[model samples]
Target: MKVTRTRLTEDEKKAWRQFCQASHASESEMLKMMIRKVSGSVSHTSARNAEPKSEKVTVRLAPGDFKKMDGRAQEEGYLSRTSWTTAVVLAALYREPVLTNEEVNALRQSCRELGAIGRNLNQVARALNIEFREGDRIKREAIEDLAERIEEHRALVFELLNKNMNRWRQ
Candidate 1:
């Protein structure tokens, strides 16, 4: 890191020392005030989106459901049925545990709904005679989202880093 140093006059030095002392206490008070201000804003925007996934599987569908799920997975975009099912469950299920039970159930229902969606979607894909591996579908979706965010942030960060690199070189 590059930092600049400067000499201060006697009057300025005394003021600077007082400012430093006051800022130390002021920083704490400022932080407390900001925390209070932001505590309300700490919304469940993305964090409280869904509930944490739990194993307690007191409910498992029949083998026929698996078969249907497999077919649906094939239609959606998966190669291996088992892996596809696991991915489906994981993707639609997991979230922060601190959320409410209603929120958790909502997420769970979404998982069930996704399975039904896959079934219906696969039927459509089948009618269209399209064969997409579930793995590829999931991967393609992930890469697309990642590429978008990376491209966005990289553009903003590149100039800052480039300037620092040049300063060091000089």
Candidate 2:
């Protein structure tokens, strides 16, 4: 055996700690196994089953459905539909709540609406603060309308969060 030394950044140190806790192995043992795997010096298998993979599954879908699935996966920042589908299926199997496409769309729309309302609110505030006294009454009425819209958007955000929270508990 040979001694090796290296430096790790703060983030790497944090990840190392997490890996150690999850893998239930000491640093030296884990590093040795990793080196062996990287160097192609060892083959891994379940202690009960030394045989390698032998099974595979294929899924079929309509072209349109596949396109939609791919679009949704990308919208959710997943690399591929397969990974997204796997995560959804695993969550379902574990009795965990996963958002449907409709729910995700609704959340996205709510975020956009809230952002627009906030911008309108800021514009109204700026208009009201301006020194031009000629349109004070009109600006006040517009501010009132914007305030009402902001409240409505806030309510929509709260409702969406409440609905998702309720669903997550199931």
Candidate 3:
């Protein structure tokens, strides 16, 4: 084995020793023991990290409702209720997310293109004597259609975004 110098805090050193003794048997059994122990505990430790990430949280559901949701989350493979809900809440909070300067400009360009498309679609709708529904209008089935369109455009968007992601030197 190639030896490399590294530093560990006292607590880390003690934890390592205890973890080795309780689970790993000895340092020679890397693949057979330590891997499994670390894999098991890492998830729980990560699950606990979800708490400090949230600010204002409310559990407004009736007594059993939250439990049901937690059960559903667990069934869907999350570690814990706090972890799952924190993720949902954070995602909701950052739904639109932030963009860099270039991204803001790119979004402006995309808006222009989309506006042009919307205008053309509106003209088509008018010619066909059909009501024009805004493409962004929310509908139950529209999510699926929007997802399909997104999948279709993903490669093109990724390429375009990657190319435009850089700074435009003034």
Winning model by TM-score:
2
When sorted by TM-score, best at the front, the candidate numbers are 2, 3, 1
Query: Whole-model Cα lDDT per candidate?
Result: 0.46, 0.63, 0.49
lDDT for model 2 comes to: 0.63
Candidate 1 local distance difference test against the native? 0.46
C-alpha displacement of 128 in model 3, angstroms?
Answer: 47
Each prediction's RMSD over C-alphas, in Å, is: 27.2, 11.3, 19.2
Count residue pairs with overlapping backbones in model 1.
5
Q: In what order do the candidates fall by lDDT, top score first?
A: 2, 3, 1
Better of 1 and 2 by lDDT: 2
TM-score list, all predictions: 0.20, 0.37, 0.27
Best candidate (score: lDDT): 2
Please, what are the lDDT tens digits per residue for candidate 3 over residues 1-170?
A: 33434588997766555444333134334333344486764422332243575466677888798887877556534444654565455445655322333344455556666566556555554544543454334333455554565554555556555543321111
- The digit string of per-residue lDDT tens for model 2 on 36-137 reads 778998654322243464455577899998897788677754544655676555555776434444455576677788788778777776776774684688
lDDT (10s digit) by residue, model 1, range 31-106: 4434556786552222112458435433377999878776765654443454344544444455212212223334
Name the regions of candidate 1 deviating beyond 4 angstroms. 1-97, 130-170
Candidate 3 residue spans exceeding 4 A from truth:
1-56, 96-170
